[model samples]
Target: MNPKDWSVSQTLMHAAKIYGEKEALFDLKRRMTYQELDTESGRLAAGLKELGVARGDRIGICLPNWNETVVLFFAAAKIGATLVPFNPMYRSHEIEYILENSKPHVLFISRAFEKQVSLSQAASLVHHVIAVRFKHKGMLSYSEIIDRNEKEMVREPIDVDEDVFCILYTSGTTGMPKGVMTVHRSVVQCAFTVSEEMHCNENDVFIVPAPLFHIFGITCNVMTAIASGARMILLEKYHPKTVLQLIEKEQVTVHQGVPTMFLKELDQEDFINYDLSTLRTGMVGAAPISPEQVQKIRKEMNFELCQSFGITETGSVTITRHDDDEKTITETVGRPLPGITVNIVDENRKPLPPGEVGEIAVYSFGNMKGYYQMPEKTREVLDDEGWFYTGDLGILDEKGNVRFVGRQKELIIRGGLNIYPQEIEAVLLKHPEISEAAVIGLPDDVLGERACAVIQLKPERSCTEDDIKQYVAERIATYKVPENILFSSEFPVTASGKIQKGKLKEQVLEHINA
Candidate 1:
């Protein structure tokens, strides 16, 4: 059977049939084989079905990298339910927005995350709250769901193209998070293509350091593993030495992460101690990596690191070939995947000539369905003809390779995570002590870019850097909080009194440099 025609659940079932008894997932010391995972997912699917989780119902999962996370993913896909994976680091402020917008029928949170994000807060927005690794007074446990039903039930057929697989919330320029409706067809297609691109097979061991909530982890690590029948090692969290140890111990052949993760592992004091010779191929993307850094990774990591470019709106569209030259890997994000059409277009949507920087537009069957409940917003980016005019600026060479230049939208990609300045600006504007706010991205060696807030205070209102940080920290994710807070009685603006972010960023950089 062709993978493109199969649903996410079907992919897992196929892997189970082909590579039964082979280790499929390893989270910490715990492990699960392909057949065990298939059975467990089926059991959980039955429980979810029994609990009124019918087709189209949204199921929210806010947990780190764990075995249950993968199980939940397959179970949701099997029963035709949409999964909404949230970053567990989010505070109540960020979580509340997503919970209300997605309005999930069920939500899964870990015991550790429950302390950070109260179960009661989510209980109001979500119908059922299932806790992992904990059984509270009234909340359901994850074990209960798996054991609630002993047998697999008949599942409704899944429409790979039409039915939504997952709803991923990504911050937008409109100052709110918009849920991108990714379908089963796009995911399955990506899995097959990426697996083939990396030359993955059943004997490969793939270790994932990125958070499962991100598309990079979901598609490249989990979905790709399922497609190729690869053994998976999921790190609960990313640590420099821990990754090196896992790669050495598990003989991880395929790995994927942002540049920061690779840097940390390389910078580990005892980096030479680990035996990473088993590493053969993987991807390094989501944030900018310098040519020098790319060279360092190739020389030190002992793996053929391929640079690729993609967004949550679309799965992995472009990837460098495994046999690419050093210059090609160093300079470009590589050519588009099979059947993927990439166009470098002008502001008017006309295709730009090679070597000219313009908005990158992509046309593929894997593009998102639309922004959930935000049709007007979706219409703005995704045209009627299936072309998604990505707000990213890029230049295409004559060879069809895409080189990313910059972002047209004022967005911050910190450590491979998308953080829209508008969303943070919206939260900053809510601070009682601020009159005007502009959040700008600053250069950073580690995080790629750190946020800095430029604020103009209201007359007679006094606030310090700590006050701003503390206040903003209370309202948004810690990652979104500005690392540098600057106060100015006034800011440069146009005749219309609109803040000039470009001008503000320049001034702030000058001030910080001085």
Candidate 2:
């Protein structure tokens, strides 16, 4: 079958027939082969159907990475339900906002978050709230729904090619989360892009540390592995030691995660104790990466490390190939994927020359249909010409490589000069004592904004604030250097492992007020 014509359900069914008893998923608690995954997922689809969840119905899945999460993903696709996945770590307000916006008829939540999130408020919209592990007085149980003796029943036929597959809510760094409407065609294209670029095969064992709710986990890891008929090891929770143990135990060949995940594993005191020789390639993205971090990953982890640039709207827009040299891999997010076109555009939306920094715009099949029920929000970024103006600032090199500068909102204007946080952060990371660094613009009465550096030092290492400022001053312009330097034991981060710059800015403000 032509891959483009196949829906996610068809793809999984095809894999089940071809791979059969091949191990498909591992979650520490249990394992499922392709056949079992397919059968169980079908059962789930039937169960959902029994509950009146027909095509076009919205279902919310708020669970961690587990065997059931995988089954629910395929089941939703099979039944033509639009799955809206929520980060399991989201608090009450965050969860309520999404629930109110998406209005999924059924919400599948993990019992573990019973204390953190209050779903009672969403009772007006959600007819049934299915708890995964534990049972509550009023909520339904996942096992009860799936054990209805409807395991082998097939779902009714629907137009899978044009139906909405899922709705993924953005991380909402700026404001309330917006749902990105994604169809099966975009997902299939993203899967093919990842499989081809990463050279995935049946023999490959993919290990994913990113949360399943994120696009990186769903498309780049889960869907990509399914497309290639590869084995996938899912981690319910991230512990650097446990992840290292899994790599040795499962003989994980392909590991994909954010830079912080890689750094935590590398910083382990007994990192050398693990047998990571099987690792051949992986990706480190979803956040800014220091060149030092990239170098350490390649030389120490002994893998052909890759970097990428993508957003929830478009999956894997650009990725540095495994065969690329260390400099190219570390320096830029490689040229756009085969079918994706990228351009650096100025404020006026005119394309810019190579080497000039501007807004990164992407045009691709992987682009989302639009933000769900948000025509105004969708039109703000996606232009009439089919271009998605990625609010991120970047530069396309002469070789078509993309160098990410910083978010447009993160740009600091000191008097009349524009200072990018990434440039200052990069200079700080070059300091041997600084392990991780983040730069943010702070309020200044005279300058409009002044740059401040927040840093986490290497273990048992210390450097005076003056010495740190001197290091950056020696390399960049005097105006670009951070006016204030502060030490942090850790930076506030999102579930997907991105440093929360807005939260960090608030921390600075609080400190000044105190």
| RMSD in order of candidates | 10.9, 1.5
Q: Against the true structure, whose TM-score is highest?
A: 2
The local distance difference test score of each candidate is 0.85, 0.88
Q: Which stretches of candidate 1 lie over 4 Å from their true place?
A: 172-174, 410-514
Judged by lDDT, which candidate is best? 2
> 1-514, model 2: which lDDT tens digit per residue?
5785678888889999999999999988888999999998888888888788878989999899998999999998888898999888888889888888998989898876666666666566588888897888877788887888466547545454458888999888888999998888778778877788988899999998889889899988999999999999999989999989989999998999999899899989999999999997887778988777788888999988899999889888999997777788988978798889999999999999998989999998878889999999999999887799889999998888999999999999999899999999888888989889999999899999999999999989999899998999999999999999999999999899999999999998999889
| Model 2 vs. true fold: TM | 0.97
Per-candidate TM-scores read 0.82, 0.97
Query: In model 1, which range of ten residues has the least summed lDDT?
Result: 493-502
